[model samples]
Target chain A: MNLVLLPEQTDSTIWQINDARQVSHLKQHLDVKIGDQIKVGVLNQARYLAEVVEIQSNQMIVTPVEQQAIPNKLPVTLILALPRPKVLRRLIMDSVTLGVEKIVLLHSYRVDKSYWQTPFLEQLDHYIQLGLEQAGDVIAPSILLEKRFKPFVEDRLSVWNHSQTTFVAHPYTTDVMPINFNQQCQLMIGPEGGFIPYEIDLLKENGCHIHHVGNRILRTETAVSNILGRLFCA
Target chain B: MNLVLLPEQTDSTIWQINDARQVSHLKQHLDVKIGDQIKVGVLNQARYLAEVVEIQSNQMIVTPVEQQAIPNKLPVTLILALPRPKVLRRLIMDSVTLGVEKIVLLHSYRVDKSYWQTPFLEQLDHYIQLGLEQAGDVIAPSILLEKRFKPFVEDRLSVWNHSQTTFVAHPYTTDVMPINFNQQCQLMIGPEGGFIPYEIDLLKENGCHIHHVGNRILRTETAVSNILGRLFCA
Candidate 1:
């Protein structure tokens, strides 16, 4: 973890960290000690230099010392086809680390029905928090689950987020992705086997520009990171 | 697996897959049946549409039906700092799937010494093969291990691969990476805490450009995919 992100803590209050996972992580991985200055950020707020003030078998305390500049999150909403159960946690954490402000896990024809049943779906917040910690950012991207693709694409996703342009990643497309794109947008990436022709057609009909990075087909997680990096240069 | 990669076979020869792993995968995951068409590729050769000629309890036979186009590999050599043991496998697989033609797992100050002791290092071929299957390509990229950072940087890496420009990833750098860079290059991505200042200076002295995607810090795998996508737009 790059940063220790705590719930919104005001100055002058003792910030206690009692969660078993975090406490163990701090003790073992970070090896925190008293008077050690650690980097921290408030949720959706500013960063600060915090000193480890207290440590016990069950908890630790940190006091914010000085404010630090927070890196801005990239203004992209990742619309991903829910991936395999095993890759779900890492993908979510990576997306958060990449600074995506929002994510939409939608159903596709190529996506396996069993994938939606994975218990990992319920632990999205855990992955998101880990991602935030890795990125040293405090804000958590809101996740939206869309089980009905047609209705959501036609009635909601197409019309929502007017300020952000929608971009869909398709490796076979002739339209190469734009470079130095300085605008907010939503990007749709397909599942493992990729979106069937009909699904791609629907996405196109819903006003999303079909874009290709190059000739190579990338895995869903790879495509997400690649497109985000290419579009936002982040 | 998008393609089943096999050893070089002549038109008249019967290609047999008797390996337990491949046979099990074909029988279970692929559900390949007799007379079913499957995508297959030759090692470092052409791709083909093949027909399942035989499906025994323990082995499978496929015959090449027609020749197909093979996607071009990206002309980039990735220089990555040794990552954690668990991540090593996925990183190698992902790098190959992303089309990196060469990889150099180099030592860095931040890299844990024990990471080099992982048994996964010996199983690199397995991950590479898996990546090839995923990408539907057969050519395996050569992986070079650089255990000594200083001498390798000064003696070999700086002089080797003159055809490829060296681009090092440094998030703290003031120089934003160039957009629309159309060149074959080698990208050096740092490990978890990133390359130390001394290492960055040494890299600069050895004619490496310190580049940043953005202000945010990204994990090694994310950086690898992001850099490959941005540099080659792939």
Candidate 2:
């Protein structure tokens, strides 16, 4: 854990850690002791250099030093066809780590209906926390689920397209990404089997310029992280 | 499987699929029947459009129409700290899928020694085949293992830097990547805990320019794919 996350407090600078995993990381991995300074951040708030004040077997107390804001979230709204449950977990973590501002779980013609019923979907916060802990960011990106492909593309997608250049990952397209793209944009990635020709046409009608990464087909998770890395200034 | 992989056959146009999984994929997923055309490639050789000639419950036979050369591999070598067995498997597949020319797994100070003893290393061909099948390519990237850090950095790393730009991923470094990077280059990614300061110093002293992806700490696999995507023309 790069930054220890703490619950928000009204008027106090002191924070307490009780999560077993975080405590274990602090004690075992970091080997922190009293008076040792470490990075800590409050959920959805600023990060701070916290000095450990008290230590116990189960808990520890730390006071914040000067607070600093987190890194800016990338101005990209990710529209992904819902991947299988196992891949979805990794995709979510990597997307959040890359600072995607918003994520929309989209249903396409190729997406299996049962993939949307995974139990992991109910525990979104748990996966988001894993991403936040890795990125050392406090803010969680907003996630929206769209089960129907046609209506969402015809109606709801315009909200995401407002002032944003939309690009869809398609294999045979001649479109190329311009270097130094800083404007807000929407990137759509299809599922394992890829979007059918009909689905691609619908996305095109909705203003998504299709682009291909390369001849090699990447997994959903790899494609997401790689595309985000390519789009953002690294 | 984007491209079904076939075993090498000498002076023969017919190929037999006996692998149960591949057979099942053909029957169930692709639903191939007699005379159905499918993409196929011999291991480390040319790709072909194969038409099914015979079919059975457990196996199938196909004849190649015409052989075509595979796409060119990316002009890059990847030097990575050996991750744990689980992540290592995915990293190998993803690297090969991204068309890395070479991969060197180096041992850093923080890398757990047991990670090198994984049984997965023995079946490296299986993993490479999966990657080749995914990427629709025949050639597999060469893999090398370096167990000692200091000696390799001082001696062997220079060979990699001879004609190629050498870059090591180091967070907080001011070095920025050049856009439209088409030249050959070597990329080094560290282990989970990252390289210690001494190792970073050794790498820099050996003509490696340190560059960081971002403030977020990416997992070894995610970082590999993301950085490769960012560095290459995807």
| Per-prediction TM-score | 0.94, 0.96
lDDT of 2 by residue, B109-216 (tens): 999899889898887778888888888898978899999999898888877677678888877677765555767889899998899999998888888989887788
Q: Per-prediction count of colliding residue pairs? A: 0, 0
Could you give candidate 1's per-residue lDDT for residues B80-166 as a string of tens digits?
Answer: 999998989889999999888999999999999999999999999888988888887888899999998999889977785455578
Instruction: State the C-alpha lDDT per candidate.
Output: 0.84, 0.84
- Docking quality (DockQ) for each candidate: 0.66, 0.70
- Candidate 2, residues A46-150, lDDT tens digits: the string is 788889999999899999887876877888899999998888888898888778889999988888899989998987776777788788888889999999999
* Cand 2, B chain, TM: 0.95
Relative to the unseen true structure, what is the C-alpha lDDT of residue A43 in candidate 1, on a scale of 0 to 100? 78
